[model samples]
Target: MSSVTSSSVSLPQGFIPVMLTPFLESGEVDYDGLKALTDLYLEAGAAGLFANCLSSEMYELSAEERLKVTKTVVAHTAGRVPVVATGTFGGPVVEQAQFVKRIYDTGVQAVIVITGLLAEEDDSDEIFIRRTKELISLTEDIPLGFYECPVPYKRLISSEVLAELLPSNRIIYHKDTCLDIEEVVRRIQVAEGYRFGLYDAYMVNAVASLNAGAAGLSCIQGNIYPELIVWICENYNNVERQEEVKLLQKFFVDSMDIVHSAYPIIAKYCLQKRGFPISTYTRREVGELTGNLQERADQLLEDVDRIQTELGIASVFRKTLEVPLK
Candidate 1:
């Protein structure tokens, strides 16, 4: 119940960025770059941070490194906003539960459970549910969330599962990657009236999902321009801004491929172009941003500037880009 514990479980509204881990050219974790990146997201109106998630290359990071990454984010944030992180890597329930406690000890409001890690592709829901229950029980009363991580495989949780788990109250957040608005609505319905929220990861139907009563967005689109995502969340229902809102929604849909080409590399490149102190060097073997993809990224940068100007939002990377929150 302390400020650093359960209280942080109530993640704020608007964009909650799935943070990218910054690395030096030699591939060491660049703590300084990570801090600067954190500043950029906050300045762009991020309501919270999803550190140590897939975007942070959690798979490549060792146990100590994962804790270090999560701890770095927690310490740098200084409680400005809530932070959540993926706790369950692929392993036995008890082993995953132990890391959950360690991640929780890093002062995260909630430790996220990756759905794919809980059971195999061929595993039955009953099996997944049983293992999930075991993981929850072993973690005691610490808060938990689920990420529909598309690694190993994209193992989704049905609304039935939500109903089964909601009574526990320990599950407070969900990063929904199902990509179907109807499915998103179903999950939201099940989560209503609890201290729970479903953050949509798909940007194509973001407007529909938000108006359908989703808590907010947690998506890759935010990695490119966090402020724009914040703007959409703040103005999604504003009658006068409907035109602007629709324009940006279309941008999210159209720009998805270009922005996602090389993943955090493309995103990092976009930031570097804006003069941020980040490198495009990524630990993941995502191909380089060259040829057609590189061309699109360049064009996308131009489009981003144009859209930001028309939308009347400033780029978080201002001239000097010294940190301040939206």
Candidate 2:
């Protein structure tokens, strides 16, 4: 493993948006569109950017494309916020470690290893521990994080595994999708005394998770209205905003299907409507968006506009590209 100072990098907190990989209408990776998207996230107050995640269509992207995209995002962000990119994708440990090294060389703060990639279905925690330990041993000095990726299968990490890993401080960030507030609290408690962060992907429990000491949010909602997520993070504890927070959380829960049912497709469409120069093309095999879905997405955007206006936060949506197309 390459040697680097992992301890010097603080794990990011706040709305670290799981970014979507923008594509041109012809289905090529839209490098220019991606630069705009990066700027859009930063302008909307994202504390960090999560590239090559599930939302970024990692399974569909070639390894070379993944590295290229990660490098583009890191160069554009220019150290304004930390970047975490997925480094493993269910392959041999050696191959996974080599990819980690390559991704770390992109100047990302940390490499996220999907927990599902460590072992097969029905594998015991002992196997998981053994494999993860070996991988860690091989990739020493490179900061690592865990993501409970839902694709292939969503393998929620057991407390035993967390207990074993957190103390070592090698795993500094966890993108948790367990969706249970109590479980999230338990995970946070397990990492208590360690320099780790748990970013909840379940938008419904974002505020509660933050209240329970979760590090921040890693959700698709951030792609559409990151400022709203940032607002909840900023004021989740304010006595005056209690009712307002509840209402916002309710909106997230109710609009889950409208905003995320189709995922990067709907997210890309939402971005296009917002004036981002990207197509709604997704690498997923999912077919084109139906008229009904398009109508629902439009309504969702309108609803979000109204909510932002009512909250006096419409100014956050202002889009000005800091990185011009080359």
Candidate 3:
């Protein structure tokens, strides 16, 4: 509510990366690196940014760090595009609502609710709906979204549950991790007239989801080769590019395991190799990048270049990153 606003018509489409938090070796948030990373995403053609997310290791960050991370992105963006952040950690509905308001005040267009953080795995949908309702009431009209974050536990909300919530006109975005195309379709079908969208995070069916009307993708793969993701989003349905699209889709399906191995570290490592000046440190305890994984990542980097060449697209980093560290 800082006078910053989203379309109210619909959320931004295409790549909305779940941002990674660059950290110093001493574990301090690297604001400078964060700024550079943000610019890289924009240069790569990201339609929006999802900061302070699970990819950003929201659980590991203190509330103060979360605010600062989000504020830095918002300030750096200076209204270039819509930005969203996870607003809920584990807490009561009221406390969660309070933090949502605080995050929205940081100038993000939407405050994302981590689904697992809202209810226990065994909790009834009725209980979950009630708490969500209470949160909506307490938070007023600030735009809200849902992330089926896997940390606490991924709570893939039912189409029934989503139907119940959309009438409020409060929920404007969804980061879907259901990994089910039919479920994604149901959510999009039900959101017909609302100012809301579902950005699919499961890349295995990225093109299928796009064809099914997903706003776009918000996935970890974007952390590694964001330009590739942007390329897919912009050309998912290009009939003439069907062959290239299928190949890219298969590449995503095959590379999923490796890309997820060392995670933000491997992602950062890959970025460093791409000539970006960002550290490979992570606060998530996702294990170190060992020799075997290192080789895989190195080979994967080569495959990325091949994909770029075959697709006739260039990595925006190559053009935007002016110098490489010796």
Best by TM-score: 3
- Summarize candidate 1's per-residue lDDT along 1-326 as a digit string, tens digits: 33444434567778899999988888889998888788888898898899998888889898999999999998999989888999998778999999899998898889999999999999999989899999988987888999999897999999988888888777888999998999888998988878888899999989998999888999987887788899998999999999999999999999888877889788887777776777777888878788787778879888989999998998878647533211
lDDT score of residue 270 within candidate 2: 75
Candidate 2, residue 277: how far the Cα is off, in Å: 1.7
lDDT of 2 by residue, 1-326 (tens): 22456666557678888999988767889998899789988888888999999999999999999999999999999989999999998788988998998999998989999999999879988888888888888887788989999888888886668998775568888999998898888989988888788999999898999999998999989887787898888888999989889989999998887776677788877776765666777889755677899999889888888888878785444446322222
Local lDDT at 124 for model 2? 89
- Candidates sorted by TM-score, descending order? 3, 1, 2
Worst 10 residues of 2 by lDDT: 317-326
User: Model 2, residue 48: what's the lDDT?
Assistant: 90
TM-score versus the correct structure, for each prediction? 0.95, 0.95, 0.96
Question: Best-fitting candidate, measured by lDDT?
Answer: 3
C-alpha displacement of 51 in model 3, angstroms? Answer: 0.5
Overall lDDT per candidate, in order of appearance: 0.86, 0.85, 0.89
Which parts of model 3 are misplaced by more than 4 Å?
Answer: 4-9, 319-326
Whichever of 1 and 2 has more lDDT, that candidate is 1
Provide backbone clash counts, one per model: 0, 0, 0
